[model samples]
Target: MKKLSNTVLATACCYSSLVAAQTTNLNEILVTASRTAQSVDETLASVTLITRKDIERSQAITVADILQKTPGVMITNRGGIGKSSSIFLRGTSSKNSLIVIDGIRVGSATLGQVSVEELNLSQIERIEIVRGPRSSLYGSDAAGGVIQIFTRRGAGRLTPSFTISAGSDGTSLAEVGLQGGDQNRWFNVTASGITTDGFDAKTTGNIDDDGYHNQGLHLRLGQRFDGGHELEGFFSITDSESEYDDFSSDRSDTLTKVMGASGTFAVSDMWLVNVSAGRSWNKTKAFSGSAFKSRHETVRDSFTIQNDLLISDDNQLIFGLDYINDQIDTNNAYVVTDRNNWAGFAQYQLTLGKSDLQFSARVDDNEQFGSYTTGGIAWGIPLNNNLKLVTSYGTAFKAPSFNDLYYPSDAYGGGNADLVPEESDTFELSLRGKYQDVNWQASLYQTTFKDMIAWAPSPTVLYPYRWLPSNINSARIRGLELSADYQWQQWLLSGNLSFLDPEVRSGANKGNRLARRADRILNLNLDRNFGALTLGATLHAEGRRYTSDSNTSSLEGFGTVDLRATYQLAPAWQVRAKLSNLLDKQYQTISGYNQAGSTALFTLAYQPQ
Candidate 1:
């Protein structure tokens, strides 16, 4: 079955490639790749930019839903909307990627993964995704890449908006927001709520329906002074409750909060300074029937200061310092509960003739693991009038999480404080071109990993039969990515394809495919606009993947199609409808987990004219 699907996809790609070969140009501005605003074509790394208009046109309800269609990205969920989810980038593990919310790192210290499922798309204005190693500019946990989300910002005159939606399975949504700003001052506030009586999450065992509820709030305020100084404050929070089927518990509640303040000053004509501080908090509680099971909480406090200097018309330099403190509180006993880390980094950019070069280095000092250094260099060459070639080499690392070193010895397993961080080196080459009405990019990359951490039986004589976390494996990952877009008059088409080979290089599981990472993925979208009405369709597909490192179980490949349409009812009102999983295909990304089937939603929105 998978082979047949692959053949069909290949044929489609060939047809689309011929149609998209004609020439086109796209000029998008992004910031996550270099920490500075620049044109997408000028950056040395592969990137994707999602704007507010794109979000609205897609009618996506969550961040994960929007990212699932992006190149070099794959998302896996255990169940419906508010369930546990994981994202893999370029064949790297979820923890290898960094998640930044308004320039602040947000994740759990113990699990070492971000809860992107809880993030509200209604409060986000833009998202920038950089697909490559980035530990040189950032401190750690960037072996895969970086994803930065920007909250809603006010612009121009005052505007107020609201949206109401109702759909299948007792699903409903409501959102309201107000944004306004002048030349010197700006503010934005938004609140939203979602509820759904979803399908069962498990295949067998429990047949009862599960339900989820979520609420989110976002606020932002900023002011610019006359002396080239600016100040800003922002806050975001999400509260959710979900019910699922488990041996001990069937319910859980989670609360996530993030807040920060920042200031920017222009000290001189050639120098600029920026400083910021922020905090992220996550709390979860589990229950078994009517009795309490357990509770866990993680909090992170972070600070950053940076300086940018213009040395010459074609040369620029940037330096920064970062500090982070992580604390964990839980009902289970552990060896340690807190830690701190600090780092300093510098970057240089230079341009000469038709070539651009970038270099960056960083040094990190952790309270538990002394010091480590990482760096990278990249070069971009203009091959012709409309074609360019870019290559880069970089080193990245992932720090050991608290659960890897501090978990108490028990029947399940014990943490090993002697465990070291995982490190990797990557080399990449890419070609980008633009021809009349089409734009395209292709990239090839390879990564070698060392000191990879895993949980297995202890080798020491002291605990021979017990399972413990250790550095027991190594891996080599290679992949190819191709993406293209073509626009003509009122019609636009875009698509992406990725092929990955993620394998354990040396271990008992050597030569085996990594768990939950698919070898092939494809995405396609087409949209057309006529007068005040628009229509769009999307197709997403992935190949079979293993469910465990041993490759004992697997899930079959599947594809899904979605349709959307929007019509303007008045100057200040609009209506939208979406039909997901139109074929009602039955498939699962995980061995025992259940995925949502056919669903539909309709929304009405109002805006002041």
Candidate 2:
């Protein structure tokens, strides 16, 4: 059957190539990384793109799964889908990475990081990742990298989709979605539910009988006036109940909801205004016989206004201001805290000689941490028609979280109000060249951090015997990345390689590598297009890494391969089959957890005209 299918697909491709011509201009892409609509190649940064086809082939369920495919990114997963997870970029600590949703920062103010597991992949249109510091464009917590997620926007008329799947771990999931409404007004809505008896807990030596269940609903609505003005609103609500294997692994049932609205208006031919506002609420409750307990309520609200002005034929200026208010009510051993923040930022772009230069600056004021300023500069110079050299330098800062400032401690918890914010300076340079049918890019960067905060054992006369948040004098990180893509008449080959070195330069951690950071990572992708059928394969390699701050525990890295193929069953429907971890390599990416091996996934997609 396989040989027959291959021959048929090849024959169809030959026929199509003889009758149709393909154009490269039709492949142009638009992105919002610089807060503007620009072609992908025009952006002067180290960017990685994950397309819808990639997502379908991977069969990912959450944002983390997709992010892990990008070069220079490492993800730590505690268990199955929807479990606790954190992301690291170029050997930077997990908290150093920032997550943005629809251009807004959504990371928890107290945890110092957001749960990427909380984001569903079903509604995402695309994900754009900019590696390295971007504090010049975004503010604090942009040290490691910037991840932006773009949700589905209605295209034409009302369209809907549904999917159901059951997997190895006794996992079952169902999802339904609807989108579209003409060209001027449209809306997209998605709802999903999942339940699992769960795979066995390797540690406890038996199947996790407790299992878990989760349900979520999401909606996005947009309207455009006849005159070219637009308004958009989005909301997401989720609830979950799950069980833990033991006291150490226990977790609380959670309920989370978020609602937001944004709009854009064309004030004149050369000026445009954009505004946005939103709110979020999170609640968690612990079950009986649980060692970890918390009944916390968090509410976040913010607003932003931006104005774009055309200074001249070669100059453009964008000025913006924003305000945020956060409130937390918790009855845990970790203390309660409240914080309000306000910020204003401005960015300017100019065409200078044979180069394009971008300047940006911002200042943020926190009620508890006072105020700080951030700034950055980006320069891009064309070496020729097919090559460009880009470089950028910026400063970023991260304020202390509620848990960092005020947690209670008998043995396992505590707080430090006197804690200061962390700051870092970053510099990066890169070259991108596109010639004929081949395109390639390479980049190098370094970052230096001051007043790095970490939980350290009390020295001499501290009250807590175990740990306390203290400032480390300095930390240093450096990395190099190379990516290339070659396209032939019927075959495409792409690969990326990254190397990172992160170390503690001062304090008790001097010479120790940062925790959960992989020193090297590599990925390669191959695709062969045969008319309405395409065959693809991917290989990933990860290097050994440490799992603890003390560097006492380690995990040996491993390699995995994935194979997939898509067949156009009909004009409107396509079927795909994928085999993940093709070699069935059994290895632990994390210290105490085992990754799934040799799994198969199949998907069917339909498009109606």
Off by over 4 Å in 1: 1-26, 409-414, 455-468
Poorest lDDT segment (10 consecutive residues) of candidate 1: 14-23
lDDT of 1 by residue, 1-609 (tens): 001112222222221111111122244556577765455777889898888778888898779999989999999987888888888999897888899988888998987879878888988987889999999988788989999888887766899999999998889999999989886788889999999998998887779888899999999888877656778889999999998886557999999999988877767656667788999999999998889987889999999998767676567677999999999999988688998999999988778777988899999998888798999999999899789999999999888888888877765566888989999999999998988778899999998899877665454565454667777568888999999998899998999999999888887888998778888999999999987999999999999999867788899999999999999999989999999888998888877889889899999999664
Residue 221 accuracy (lDDT) in model 2: 78
Error of 2 at 405 (Å): 1.7
Using lDDT as the measure, which candidate wins?
Answer: 1
Report the alpha-carbon TM-score of model 2 versus the true structure.
0.89
Clashing pairs in 1: 23-435, 23-436, 23-437, 23-438, 24-435, 24-436, 24-437, 24-438
Q: What is each predicted model's overall lDDT from 0 to 1?
A: 0.84, 0.71
Per-candidate TM-score against the hidden true structure: 0.93, 0.89
Quote the lDDT for 150 in model 1: 84
